[model samples]
Target: MMKHQIARVLVLVSIAGTCLSTASCQKTDPNRKETIPVCGEVYVDGQPAAMLQIQCHPVEGMDTQQPTITQAVTDQEGKFQLATYEAGDGAPVGEYKLTFVWQNFSAVAASYSGPDKLKKRYADPGKSPFPLRVEKGKQVDLGRIELSTK
Candidate 1:
């Protein structure tokens, strides 16, 4: 009887351990909203614009009080993928105004800083010329956005 009881306790402890491990392994957040994939490219003077910062600002009629602003940095190929909650997870469905800012990289500071390469022309969402609409269950490909230094 003593041996049987010990075995039962061991099994119960193992089951409890498994349950805790499974619950802890899950990274999903209950409050996390659904997101759709968004991708695009940037061009300046008909050339690929690399290392530019792109932001999606929620416009009117959307949740601006606690808005989830999606953002991305252009790769060397000038490609970008908007991420809000996680890397490459995309943004929630809404109407957004796009903003772009290209800052010079400072090796001394070990970060990208300094004045805007675009001269803050695309820094304000209110004055942003690019208006984007993200639909439910639909992927948004903005194609190529052309800019000019002139």
Candidate 2:
């Protein structure tokens, strides 16, 4: 009877350990909203614009009061993946006005600051020329965006 009880306790502890491990393995955030992949490439003056910052501002018909702006930074090849809640997780479905800002990275300041390389031409959402619509359940690929510094 003592051996049986010990075995039962061990089994229970093993089951509890398994349950805890499984719960901890889950990566989903309870508050995360569903998202679809959004990617694009950017070019400035016909050349790949690396380290450019892209922002997606919610437009009319979407929640702007507590808005979540989707954003991404261009890779060396000018490629970017928009993320609203997590890296590369994409954005929620909505109409958005796209803004761009290219800044020079200062290693001395450990930041990407200084003057806007694009001269703030595409920095304001109110004055942005790029308007996009992210659809539900469908990946958005805003093919090569062309911008000008002049």
Q: Pick the candidate with the highest TM-score.
A: 1
lDDT of every predicted structure (CA atoms): 0.89, 0.90
| Structural similarity to truth (TM-score) of each candidate | 0.87, 0.86
Q: What does candidate 2's lDDT look like per residue over 34-63, in tens digits?
A: 788999999999999998999998887446
lDDT digits (tens) for residues 30-147 of candidate 1: 6677999999999988999988999988887457455576899898889999999988888888889999999997667867888898999999999999998989999999999998
Identify the runs in model 1 with alpha carbons over 4 angstroms from their true place: 1-5, 24-27, 61-66, 107-110
* Clashes per candidate, residues 3 or more apart or on different chains: 0, 0
